[model samples]
Target: MQTTSTYKILVVDDDPDIVELLHYNLTKEGYEVEQAENGKKAIDTAVAFKPDVILMDVMMPVLDGIAACRQLREMPEFRQTHIIFLTARAEEFSEVAAFEAGADDFITKPIKPRALLSRLAAYARRDAQQEGLDEVIEIAGLRIDRTSYAVYKGDEKIILPKKEFELLAFLAAKPNKVFSRDELLNNVWGTDVYVIARTVDVHIRKVREKIGEEYIRTIKGVGYKFNTD
Candidate 1:
């Protein structure tokens, strides 16, 4: 895992206390953290800082997290920003709204430090891959050399679970092409294993988390695709 100090993160929220609390823990873990008090500032700060991931509060003053995220999506530099919403609301609509607004994940507060760290680490792994350079099997930024289990981005290597690494290799071989969950199970995991479709989402979600959201695109109502461009 890449050290947190190497990763930059943007936090968007209306509450100063929440921002402070988050910053404290994030820093304690060695991550570089920046704060944006409202929706508009979140976009500006995120673009200016180019954080590895954004931990955004759904409700904020000025632009609000959802609006800010939409704006962020317009910037070419952040086409792949991993946006995780920090919200008090956990209703289905709220969750759907977050995803619809381009959020990558959701974490409802009161915060669980350990769980939060784990999720953040998972994202950081994805971010680190953005700089990888595995020429043999390249999918956007992820690299996989069948001869070696190691995956590198630029000069930095990414640590991944066995299944995760294999899954990535399978998908990177065909960048930006749509693949249904069933197809992936048959091609990557094989059809013999009767896995639920949620398993595919979970792995794809993790893949997007480590590789950046722009690294993959969801075809809404269809399947997930690798974003070759």
Candidate 2:
């Protein structure tokens, strides 16, 4: 199914063998792969290639994966890129650390080709929706596209998950207006699902990570508002 359609991928690793292996496997799967030996190079390649996903190593020359992810998160070009770490560290602490550092997924070394392919496909499926988003609601330099399932800072796409996309769409659908979490649940997620109102906070956090800390303004004791002011 994936062989006919090609998706661009950036593989960041200091080891030539690992990079080659990823490139080989991904290419075999009909994905176009790019390589970077260090964190800075990874960022450069990401900007230049506009990859659908990034497979990164936690330990690299110059800057590490955590630092690299933070830097990429700051850039508008890569705001929404699906970043997965391919590393040797399999400790529980490392997994938590990866997510805290902005990694969408993590794969341990001694690579399992099938698992890597599956996870990468999942990321691509989400990003494909983002890449096609052109139904834009432009608010100054910011944009929200419901059809594409994408948000952009000027020309740079902001990577967001489906839940976060829906959350932002709901909030932006009525900009500057406060909709309590209960109301949001009723409207956005639909009723009768029995989801926690606290789930809104998790989606909001992910949204903020893509946009900015200040983009969604809290209404103190109520709900959230997309700052129109």
Candidate 3:
């Protein structure tokens, strides 16, 4: 299992106080930490730092967190990196936008240090569990490569954000087996993370958009199943 000391975190926010707070708390918990004041700086710093996780604030000058996350998701190296968005705005749109931009999780601020630490610890545990499962699932014409976090449909390469990719891969691995939203959340996002059932629906929609609707079928009242026939 990977220790907290080995985990690297990048804290991105325009507020100096927030940056300092996160840096202090993260380091105190034994994580290696780096700070970036804005989205552009975050990207540049991430290229060099290669953090395992990024804590990004939603609004900032020179580039917003959503756009930054979109750009980061495009980069092959950052595909597997966990990007969590922090925002003062608890608006539903803000949350939806964050997920659309490829964020792994969303947290509302007046930041609670203890809760945030618990969340980070959950990510570390998930990483350790993932180390043992290296697999590739080829279903129909779609190829889901867990090793590279890449997906290819026949000759076309598709880019799916980390969570979407995991959700798709989990379903594909057990073709024709139906999994409810709660089941998927527990398996893919883990029980420690407090993601809503709707998140699974949103991720499923995004996966289908990238890979085509034929691969995953909705069971209406129950949940979803990867279509093999």
Best-to-worst ranking by lDDT: 3, 2, 1
Local accuracy by lDDT, each model: 0.71, 0.75, 0.89
| Residue-wise C-alpha lDDT for candidate 2, range 76-186, written one tens digit per residue | 567556778888988767766666666666778988777788766555454444445445677745788876667889768876655577678767767899989998876
Identify the leading candidate in terms of TM-score: 3
Number of colliding residue pairs in model 2: 2
Error of 3 at 82 (Å): 0.4
Q: Indicate the residue-level lDDT of 205 in model 3.
A: 90
Ranking of predictions according to TM-score: 3, 2, 1
lDDT of 3 by residue, 49-138 (tens): 999999999999999999999999989889888999999998888888888888899899999999999998888777677667757778
lDDT by residue for model 1 (1-229), tens: 4577888889888888888988999899898999988889887788689887789998877778888877776565665566778889877677666655656667887867677778777655544453464436865565776445457777777654434555677677777778888887666544333334555677677666765678668888888776776
Q: List clashing residue pairs in candidate 3.
A: none
Model 2, residue 48: distance off in Å is 1.5
Comparing candidate 2 with candidate 3, which one achieves the higher TM-score? Answer: 3
CA lDDT of 101 in candidate 3?
Answer: 85
